[model samples]
Target chain A: MLLKLLIFPGFLFLFLCALFFDWVDRRMLARFQGRVGPPWYQPVADLIKLLAKEDILPTGVNPLTAAVLPMVSLAAVLTAGLYIPFGAFSTASFEGDLIVVLFLLSIPALAYFLAGWISTGVYSVLGGSRALLQYFSYEVPFLMALAGPAILAGSWSITHIVDYQSQTIWIALMQPLGFVLAIIGLIGKLKRDPLDIPKAKSEVVAGSLTEFSGRKLALWHLTMNMQTVVGIFLLVNLFMGQSSVFGPIPAFLSFGLKSVGILLLLSTASALYARLRIDQLATLGWRVLAPLALVQILVATWIGG
Target chain B: MASPLRSLAYLLPQLWRALKEGPHTVKYPFDPVELPAGYRGRVIIRAENCRGCSMCVRDCPAFALELEREGRDAYRLIYHPERCAYCGQCELSCNFDAISLSNEFVPGKPDRKDLGVVLVNKEG
Candidate 1:
């Protein structure tokens, strides 16, 4: 049980997948911008370099909280990974695990908010506040979007959603608006381009992470990468239908291909759009995305009922 | 503000073209850089052609050139490339074509003193 949890579908697998996906995302984004991207091993090399660097703590902040926030965020994302059904394989799938996974997925954002709020820097506080504010804007739509899939499948479990889609059609096909909303929400949640207001280098100079360095910073990066993998996997299982398209093809390979397609779409969107202002994002979310998500839910409910 | 659909229509083709054409950036270090014509780089001096008139030294804005006159048309041209601006003023000021900027880029060196080069004219 320990071996299964720790190796195949757990930390090691998630870690590698996170690095690989990061590379793919970066490469695609670079290609879209007409620039050569980093080599495949750049992510791993960066993690190693960060881990090996010296850890510096600014004076006047609580050392324990500073140290613990990143770990907490990382742990939360990793735990969320276990509940997700990767290619129909899950170590801890249970009733209402969807809610649990969503809840678990949100811990990092809170931790990020605290990470900025607790720090004494001007940029950190500003970034922290932005992260918290943006959370409300995207999270509502994100939740509603995921809820569309759940309502249609009639189960709050990821495995059941995948199973339901395998029998019928992809949730994406049933309600593409929800899929679009979910993808946008995922970008906001991950703080990628167009929604990366909190960490805009020019505006905030690494934003909430301005003070972080060495091991803590490395952990934060790993947590973000891991969260990306988990988020994409969750979306794939929710909207991409079955793990196997036809007989003789393994489930994981199909899942991987679908995930790659999603990643490409994400990278394309990221490259195409400029970052929206805080006010613009809030307006778009409440006025546009949230309403559309609500409509998607109604449509899903009507279809399911 | 352009509508989202219009923006998408404009950007999608650009992104597609960029992806198909690959990166426009030159892979430096991995590939050699192609220098354009009349590219100013390191300075080279011909001591035998020098008139000891100190025109190059006087014209050098960076004060990188020092011509020590030994005799009529005999000189020691000392060039401090570390301080050179590569403005080509010295090259233009040389009446006898004693000095010119070559197209060879200067590589970085640890020691500051190694950046200087000297050309001695014994025959006057």
Candidate 2:
């Protein structure tokens, strides 16, 4: 109990920072709209309210699966978060690699799919299907882009990737194609806006989260925010160095802020755009992005080789 | 397949607009939103024509309007703006036609007390 309590503050801090980024993104977008914007501390207020709200379980749903969905996603994320090399917070050297982190990121989607299907609704099933399909469409290009740095660094370890960037020029300059592809992949992973076909508000009514209310909705919502932070971290650590020293402050805060910028670009861009039809996303990925990524990889290797 | 690409092609203009245009999403608190036609805003009331007869108070389903005493014929109209359901029922049945809903649905309130619109009829 004591040990867990001690760990509590650290966990709270990570989550709070994650929530902070989400709030900042929203507020920034609100700023773009010429609004006063949410208070900087809005995410904290939202989470506190959520925690206090009662958890509503689905009636006669697979209790085990329903219980497990958020747990598995949260566990995988927290585990992956361990490997994420922020300035001072990144601790473990190599309990996992880039591939492992990438794969673990998918666990949330698995939990999401199960959550959708177990809810016993048509929209849930369709949404779950769309989610899985989205997984396949985007994961390939994303991995290839992720592999862009690995190709140069010649290692799968995220630390190695970051340390490699720290040694060399940032990967964004060397691999613009990879960077763009990776960002698109990141957007897909976050399931925001155009790629939010799974829970497309037009069709599925929050899709997987259709039946969830109160605290369950809140947990999923919070996790959604955390996922954006994680996605941004992966982008930063892979393409932008998290540990490079700056004037007085370690560049971790820079990572945090820039991640918010990328997320801001996403959320605003999303508000204006409509969701892509499922088939379009598939064809776009397979026909366009896959080829682009494969060629970039071939070219990067050739130039570097 | 064809349509999405087409849609993507169509969306290019919007992207171009975003790139070329200034920030169109007007800042909220510091800068106010431009209320276009059919702008759903808080209800505003004209104080004079309203008779002390409480049709608006009775007609309001959301209980957003209040007929309070300010002075003789100066009935204090406290409009709890947040309590407004935007149902427009209060706007419809104003027999004196003293009240009208504006397009300015800002939802701004420092507290529940601040949400009210207080007006009194004067014999001007």
The number of the candidate with the highest lDDT is: 1
- lDDT (tens digit, per residue) of candidate 2 on B20-120: 55455455657866778676577877766677677778988888788876666656667777777877787788888887788766554566655455755
Counted clashes in each candidate structure: 0, 19
lDDT of 1 by residue, A179-258 (tens): 99999999999998889999998898887899999999999999999999999999999998783556534687788899
Candidate 2 Cα errors over 4 Å, as ranges: A1-10, A242-248, B1-124
User: Which candidate should be chosen as best, given DockQ against the real structure?
Assistant: 1
> Residue A91 of model 1: what lDDT?
88
lDDT of each: 0.90, 0.75
Q: What lDDT is obtained when candidate 1 is compared to the true structure?
A: 0.90
List of clashing residue pairs for candidate 1: none
Q: What DockQ results for candidate 2?
A: 0.12
Tens-digit lDDT string for candidate 2 (A1-305): 33322242235545876778777767655554444457878887887887787777767688677766887787777666666766544556573478778888888887888888889777888888899999899989998988888877777788888777777788888898899899889888888877999999878888888877666667777777778777787888888764454642546567667666677767666755678999999998999999999998898788667
**Local distance difference test, candidate 2:** 0.75
Runs in model 1 deviating more than 4 A are: A243-249, B1-4, B69-74, B121-124
The number of the candidate with the highest TM-score is 1
Per candidate, native contacts kept equal: 0.83, 0.07
